[model samples]
Target: MAQFYSAKRRVTTRQIITVTVNDLDPFGQGVARHNGKALFIAGALPGEQAEVTVTEDKRNFAQAVVKRRLSDSSERVAPRCRHFGVCGGCQQQHASVELQQQAKSRALARMMGTRDAPREVDEIIADNPWGYRRRARLSLNFHLKSQTLQMGFRKASDKELVNIHQCPVLAPQLEALLEPLRQCLSELKAVRRLGHVELVLADSGPLMVLRHLSPLENGDRQKLEQFSQTTGVALFLAPDSETLEAPGNVAPWYHSDGLRLSFSPRDFIQVNDAVNQQMVARAIDWLDIQPTDRVLDLFCGMGNFTLPLAKRAASVVGVEGVAALVAKGEYNARHNSLKNVTFFHENLEEDVTRHPWAALGFDKILLDPARAGAPGVMQHVINLAPQRVVYVSCNPTTLARDSEALLSAGYQIRRLAMLDMFPHTGHLESMALFERI
Candidate 1:
């Protein structure tokens, strides 16, 4: 039995009520209004009637879990993964693909509001339904009393860990190595000191980075080497903040397009390679850059888009806050012989209106910002009114907020599409094309 961390409160069981789900909340939970108060129920699809047991009651709304389905929606499908409810990794595995896409479109539309919403929504880009995840961070916990290693995602609404034997979303190689890894860890004395395991599947093979709090003994090192030899997965050790070392002949993971991009186990890279390829192609296609066009690529990391855009544009300026990434981007540009691209390291969050580039006219602009969105960059965008702007966002709410700002700045949304970069989840990747009115 798993031990769950719970908040202190009085436990009261309310009467089981049958409610018809009317819509979905932002997190994809089915929403139903009961007696003028909103009820957010998990495992209940929109348009379906279900008996729910209220788990949490709040001032404005209540949360419940489906006790029994009275009427099922056609959109509800049998979830493929057995760990769907226990693991917090996937939220919409029970929803049909069509229904999931519709829900995402509706969510995006609601965020953008009716005035400046996309006139037509494109079909959500779906990839492999299973075994598509190429990167994952699995939390590690050792129960000394049970003498067992616990590895997997955290439980929903709780801090308890779910010891998953096999994950449907992980690549087959990584999935097959899970049990062996657990067994290996069980034998190691340093298992108690292990905090987490970061798994990265490159084009070549899978690599395991063990995050440990203490140094491993020689016997533990031998065990790791034996496991790596048997499983053919490279083993890396992150013993402390300053040290990261690989035991055997493990090469660095390099993701390449026109130029090779190298990063340590810690650097950020899109997990899904196939979808990332499509996303990059889509962003470039939407930009519709010309040879004479001058472009500005904001929040550029290692020249993912900057180098590609440099191939078409007259000159592309890439700005990134991290000096290391900016240096890497410059090296990649030079390695690819992309002479038209220039990298600048600056804090984009600060005002750049007084910068020299603020006066340098740019015909096209492309922004791929983090989840916080690009409010600071938006001001610069308003100052430097580019003829065409392509915005790629991982968060819908921030995208909507920035879209509203751009709309007020006399930019009309020309095209918008959602890419299902992450499947079986509520996360959305959206791209919008804005042209100056």
Candidate 2:
């Protein structure tokens, strides 16, 4: 028999080091240098000295958590939410809103200039820094130790939920329901069966969607209904992920560009209504739509932009990947009595020129692609050679990557604006204008 020697597992000790922060990155992490390697410290701002513990050790960069800040930046301000640092809902709450906007503006400029494109960020669109969030999702977990249901958002960098009693970022109406909602859930007989809760404020009022893994008892159902009736919140229950049941048969709707648009609870809508309205206005202004110009709107979600553009242009064609939104768009167009706009359901990831709608000449084009950006459609846009193009992007990195194709095709970036769609968060939304030279 051969004897093999097994070495004992070595325990790596965490290193605590003091570093001087140099700058803030786009993701709201403080950048520092240690031992010739880049160090990223969380909860630390620029122009601050912090003692940090390294959490991740990489070849070129290390990630650390701030143990304490020996010095603070003048831009630092007290966060409004008590759960600011722990909750994953926000990242820049410690920094002043002005500082956060400035950091974002600088980061946006750098991302756009990566391909040697224009470095100027033309405008920054912002609104009230607090109480602007019209939507939020709360996590639910049954704690065995305490024998209670925990309702809150997930902790930063952890799967555990933070018991949020008050969230300042939520709209005033939604935030007011936090305590009552938690109390009501605690009394439910099927509390353990609850998965999560989604709160959304439509133009009509605030609506609640309760997700449950199992069927609720009769008493529990009555309790939920009573809670809804008492609070005046439209309540819907989800027995499964895909199924939603509204006892009152309520239809949620919102207004945009003076048009009332009805949407399902799970449908996509902007969280910040004020900023969304402004964004739509700016996009139209940049496109410079004329009455005789035929416009093409890609990834047009439920005619959010298509209908608005239709009000100005001769003909507006809205293309969406989701068939449901296409139907909704058509319904909204009819609802708004705008016959000039047409909605089509098509997958934008493939060659779109084969579609009959693509064959039609469009003088101006606007696209609001998701985080993946418009990968397969950029070349087609270039091929069409529209007189003007407007791109609304949620991710700056992808926007920069996709802009290269447009720049190579003799489309000059005429304007760029940083949209503060989500305040106190690292989300960077932007709008750009490009004109054929």
Candidate 3:
């Protein structure tokens, strides 16, 4: 057994200590107590003995990094990616996929105040834990010293970019483009001007968006086109545009559940395709739509759920904050020949309860808000008097905070489960069904 030391032993900065991890933080860092205060260590797993060197000391807690693992947790496993520990993109890769899912569920339950409150994980919607990411935004760093380009995700604990030759988490097709991209860019006369790259596996095929700080020379442009042709991946250029949509003809889309959702490359879409299908099916099933029921979908980006929900309900209305996404949603509804769906552009965070759609009153409502959450929009939902509300959350903290408002408004949580939308990462996406008490 590794020796343990109590924090009362005159803790000091830069001190080395051995501690057994008790739990994991939401970010997947190990948590332990010392001298009646909590300490966090990265790369440490619960039930493992971590030899750590303290990096930061505060009145209540400390932050440390594991210098060595004296004993490993049974649930821990080898991460598949070479960049697992260094890349900030993934945190829970060191743990088994099963353990990762369980931890996420526990975190969600605790955050929602339903910990040990008797709600079972009716179904854990998940898919392949590796090679599932279809979209990735890579950092571009040109190393003049080596006269080479470094493209990858940022480092785990800092903004420094980690050069990656290959990534296992990205879709195989997208993953194949990394080396080719680096090689082709190295041949360019103006490689140093490159800023960032966004890769998306569009319905048509793989699409790569090359962001450059300045205009590309004709020779460099030809090289990019050659690279795209060689890889069979569509190449789009971004002139330092933040939205990342280069003016061109590619309208990327994805088909699922008898609907085709089209959106800009920069728009938000669920990463795990297999799990996303399951999530959509589960959401619709939980809503229990009736032919006469009116359904309202908030934050409807490109009609991911609205189109499918429209197929079953008498009428479905989708409201989105982004006008571009609203337009895309309308186009998707029209393209899919789905007649019962109507999309409106509205900022749900604002005082839009008076929106015309609210006057119609919905039988059920679905909310798929961003990490910032719906932001006190339950009042509007209550006023609409929807018999049921299904919330799909990407962040538990925000969901938990909003649950308070929902509970106060007389809503009862009927079902809750965590969706492993992002496996091998600490990111948790949850779905909950609430019925009026």
Candidate 4:
């Protein structure tokens, strides 16, 4: 039997007790177990001693805030970003880049267990430590008393907005337009109706997408257009799903890898351009496609990887759930003059065995499924029996679950590497190569 503490009872009060951090949790918070109960201490690094004040006490674990750093880890460093704590965007900014990679790698290794894991872990794929984000979602809040437009990310664990003047993680061009955007929004009468603003950077320029709950008047539209023309930022309005319109001469712009990949503002694309390029290169390298090899890409979006794979393989088939994206993907393939690639629209959530494309044999397979993972597509991989499988994942838990399924299907994980795609934050991107046993 275990003893329990009551919520009304104060277990510890301002007790300046020194504790050593055991490790960091998924959220980059330091983890330490005290009296068989876990304590998640913020601003503390692993292998370091810190004085902490308990913020919230729970039956199983407690949460605390660090008061003083008695001893610091070698990996501890001053954060580079000004809005590091207030923005809640980057959690590992205080930790060294090398230590951050090590933490991510250790997390992946633990998730995949050591029973039959690979002996050699691939080198970490690094990206620009700052100003690499190509897309961002900025919240919009208007204060009735102050008559000011508060635009930025929400503070951690609160609805209060941070109101950032500049973001180091965003593209330089987009970051430079933050104050201009705030000024433009502040001048509009319909600014109160705008709830959020999303920025996506294409090769041509930055696109500013505004999410407004109410219809904009003519004057408000003119304000947006003037801002767009003055700052050279494209403006997009989103009052509803059916009401996605661009005002003025603003046209859709896209970022590509020498291959056309036009997408709507709502579509999902990798946020870090440099890291994505490296990740794509790594995925292609792991494929090791022979000139005669046929490749099949699952959950392919906008032919990001499909068109690239087509260049190396004899034929490539891409499957996606969104029909619009499939059409764009096919158009991209055609524009790139890659006749070897074909895009199909199918609901991968349902059974894909009956699909006509499933009958086609493939030599190599690549999967970049969403956070839910490819649970419905795993059995199909067994049925297709591709010689090699390359999987890129964003969720480690789901990746581990899917990896176990692949292992049961006689696929052995050969190599794996972590890409610090979202550096500063706890989000991790990983790539794994599995060979048919």
Candidate 5:
């Protein structure tokens, strides 16, 4: 189907339009208007005048990026990362951390409130702003024209590869391998057959998973092992038939709140260690589990909170949509020797009220759904009659939508806090506690 667009007038591409940024959107884009239609300009801050080029013209709105800044905002700060504008890994780096937190805090408050006046906000939970990311996915751009492999990140605006020498956001040990991996890949004849690579800094050490379309020769395998031995990066190659190429290794585990969690190489884990720790601590405290309580955890990945809740509650049942995560959750429970905790495989988005697991009454419930939010199951939450519910969210817009559903079902928000998980990015992580009226 062809796309229909709304515009004040037909505008040609690459047309330069001077506009004053009125405010910032959740994506860090500057919001403005031209001829009554909304225009989004990237890299332009509020209270600044910028000359932007129209990149995409759409119905009701258009996308653009600032070509030149004519005026500056008082909150703008120098970005710490040299590749800030190009790498696309980090956004809102030019703004002060204080302003970024304030923006996110107010956004959440506005979503939670009945009026425009800023809702009363508790202090934000924060940690070190830099070197917080523990896991990174680097791209493999095999250029046939130049016969070179660009092992780095893509540009913020497009799929064009931007070769990185170092990334300031990644942990120190992982950042040091940026150039080394590039050099190592350059010598491989199978470089073009390589897929994207995932580099992770686990509590045990650094691990690398290389997805390959073709097999690596014996010589190449030896070279990779040597690279691993020299750099101490546990390298595993997928799609290889032999276990020798990809070591059959146990899941890497991280300890938090007296519980040990083991996750697969590809399993999701919080990238910011410090903030994740605090987030877990807050969840456990807010839930106020009791020895006679049976708690239900929705979207519980790898038992991050299930095991901790198990220590206080009579029993904790963790439900995950992904079998891999459920398996890891079971493994983590065994690794931690928590007999009161159990994991079940079920899609949280589907109706599961009849599932035998749901037959058990839950005194309190905790939800840590993905960015899409857990709207499908929210309408049925009242059936369980949980006394309290703690919601952990990554997206504010979705959280607001779900909160309304819970409110209509007789739940009142008791406590809320904004977690500064990604300090320099235009991302928001919030935790709220709601009680049945």
Candidate 6:
């Protein structure tokens, strides 16, 4: 065992230390303590002893990389993807899914003040851990010396790209096209001009969007179109950042609660479709919507929750920051023949209490804010004084910070669940139901 000692930053000297990991943080880093400071070790797990080298030293905590894992935890498992360590897409693949969820729940419990308290995660919503990603964005790089094209995810914590031959996490329909798509892009005359590619598996069919820096040659266009026809993948080209051109009329849409929502290629749809469906259902159930209840949904995108809530409530008002999405939400309401739901475009970061929709009393409120969280809107939400509020968050840190206002306003947590939206990854998504006390 190595000695525990504090040292100043050195230019050449190296020090190795042995530490016993006591716990796993929510982001999957192993937690250890030495000399009254926490040490976060990478590639280590709870109940494991690791020989590690401190990479960065700070006052409260230190970061280290394991030189050798002296002991392994029972939760450790072989990763399915060959590029597991190299690719930055996933962090917790070495740990079992059950362990991952447990760590996440513990972290969430601590964040929500339910760890040693009465409130705890009521349920953990999860699905097939592998092959669940319905959408993916792949980076492209053209090597000058080899005269070849490399396509895949980025390297872990680095800008270099890892050439992926296969990805097990992608939906089977989209994963099957990886090799063929790579071959097709390599053969294109404008291969050097390719920027990146995005693959999405919709209920209707698979769709591909090629981001190219320069105009494609006529022959290259024909080749892409041919590839699309052969593979039955709808093809779209992005000549610039803002525009998307489809060779064929392709309107991609996915099924949610028996409603059809049409979306453009670049729209923000849930990466895990199965979890999204279950999440929507659970959100509705936890809200306990009644026929007489009028609900307000903040940060609503294309009626994912708005239209679904409309099914249970008397009226649902959807507010979105993006005008395009608000327009699409209205279109989807009309498409679904849902007359009670209305969509309004408003900047949620500002004071929205003065908005016309804000004036009307709502029995229930639901918010699905982005990673930044609803900074300026949380207090406003408290002012509305709805009977129930369900907050769906992608970032737990922000969720905890924003929950202060609601908790202070006498809103007690009625239910909480951990949404395993992205498995084998450090991203934690959760939902909390708060009822006025």
**Which digits, one per residue and each the tens of the lDDT, describe model 2 over residues 102-166?**
78888899999965654789999999989999999999988989998899999887988999988
Candidate 1 lDDT over 1-437, as tens digits, reads: 99776777546667688899998764669999986899999878899999899888888999999999999898889888888988999898888877777778777766666666544555465677678788899999987778788999999869999988888888787788888888998899888889998888876578999988887899999999899898888888888865789778566555555556655666677877777777777778888989999999999977778888898899999998888789888877777788998888888899887777667889999999999999998977977889889998999889988988899999988888877777778788788889999
* Tens-digit lDDT string for candidate 5 (152-266): 8888879888878888778888988888887887788788898778888888788888877887888877777788788888887876533323453535667788676677677
Question: What would the TM-scores of all predictions be?
Answer: 0.91, 0.95, 0.93, 0.92, 0.90, 0.96
Q: Assess each prediction's global lDDT (C-alpha) against the native.
A: 0.83, 0.92, 0.85, 0.85, 0.84, 0.92
Each model's backbone clash number: 0, 0, 0, 0, 1, 0
lDDT of 6 by residue, 1-437 (tens): 89665566435645689999988887778999977999998878999998999988899999999999889999999999999989998888999999999989888888888546735788999999999999999999989988889999998889999999889999999989999999999998888889999999999899999999998889999999999999999999999989999989899998999999999988899999999999999999989999999999999988899999998899999999999999889989999999999999999999898899989998999999999999888888898899999999999889888888899999988898999999988889999999999
* lDDT tens digits by residue: candidate 4, 49-123: 888887887899988889888898988999877878777887878888787788788778778776576334577
Winner on TM-score between 2 and 6 is 6
- Candidate 3 — which residues are off by over 4 angstroms? 1-12, 114-121, 242-248
Indicate the residue-level lDDT of 110 in model 4: 75
Worst 10 residues of 2 by lDDT: 3-12
What lDDT is obtained when candidate 1 is compared to the true structure? 0.83
Candidate 3 differs from the real structure by a C-alpha RMSD in angstroms, to one decimal, of 5.2
lDDT of 3 by residue, 1-437 (tens): 89788778865559899999998876788999887899998889889997899898899999999999999999888888888888888898888777778778777777877646745555678888888999999888889888778888899779999998778889998898888788888788877888888899977789888888888888888888888787877778888676454334666778879677777777788888888899899999999999999999999888888999999999999999898888888888888888898999988878985778878878999999999998758778878878899999998888888878888988988999899888877788999999988
The most accurate candidate by TM-score is: 6
Which of candidates 1 and 3 reaches a greater lDDT?
3
